[model samples]
Target: MVAMVASSLFASLDKDGDGKVSASELRGCMAAALGEDMSEEEAAAILAAADADGDGLLDRDEFLSLAREAECAADEGGRYECLREAFGMYANAADGEEQCITPASLKEMLSRLLGTSQHLGMEECRAMICRFDLNGDGVLSFDEFRVMMHDGLM
Candidate 1:
């Protein structure tokens, strides 16, 4: 039943029938849902968050995860919650709790997203945080994280 629902949603979004969902297709759906167009940055943020294999497209499992999120999200606030849920996926919080996106968590998540078998070095992660850490606290608050995801999009 779940798989059927997932495939149905994926089929609806995979307009090109390429066995993957592109950012453009997703953008269209989001635009309809939000009643306004989504910028390329916002679309890219969604894809970047969900594209586990780093293919720049959403395959079944990836799309299914995102679709499941959207299933519970019906409006703008729900949309934000969906993104937050995606953000939570990469949470590698130390001490078994997450308050923000720290260098260590960013390092782990980026290494996985970049498909790097080796760690993505602490210095690089710190640099990434520095670029968008508006608070200068050496970590990414959700707002900072959103800026980084939507702007830098790495």
Candidate 2:
């Protein structure tokens, strides 16, 4: 079933009657799948991230990887839940009350997000806290995090 679906998808994406999906073809496919015209930069980034070979095109396997990633990322609700779960994982303060992510924890999360080789400096972390801290308590409550995540803060 999966093979048949992938074959059909590949055929659809291989525009211009080409045997392979070029970068432009992949970008068009993504735009169509996402129901919006993706920016050139976004399309290029997706192609670069998924293209295993140096060639700037997506073969069947590469396209399958992109499809899987897009499938996961397209679920906004699931993404939010995953983010909430991450917040909970890092907000581990056994104070027996409502706990929040401290500046230190936020820094750790940011560092992890950016990769361990490039940890954000204290100044950067503080700035992020300042941006997200609604009540100005120097830490992020779950509500504040929700607002930051879902309420147009991006």
TM-scores for the candidates: 0.45, 0.47
Model 1 Cα displacement at 54 (Å)?
Answer: 22
The number of residue pairs in model 2 that clash at the backbone is 0
**Model 1 off-target regions past 4 Å?**
1-75, 92-98, 117-119, 151-154
Error of 2 at 60 (Å): 16
lDDT (Cα, tens digit) per residue for candidate 2, span 5-117: 55666777776656667767767655544435777777677677888995877788887776566555758788777668757855747568687888787676555433344
| Candidate 1 lDDT by residue in tens digits, 16-135 | 779998889888765543346888888889899999999899998898887666655557687577568756755546685556878887776555433333457899888978998898
Reference-based TM-score, model 1: 0.45
For model 2 the TM-score comes to: 0.47
Q: Which sections of candidate 2 miss by over 4 Å?
A: 1-80
Query: Per-prediction RMSD in angstroms?
Result: 14.0, 14.2
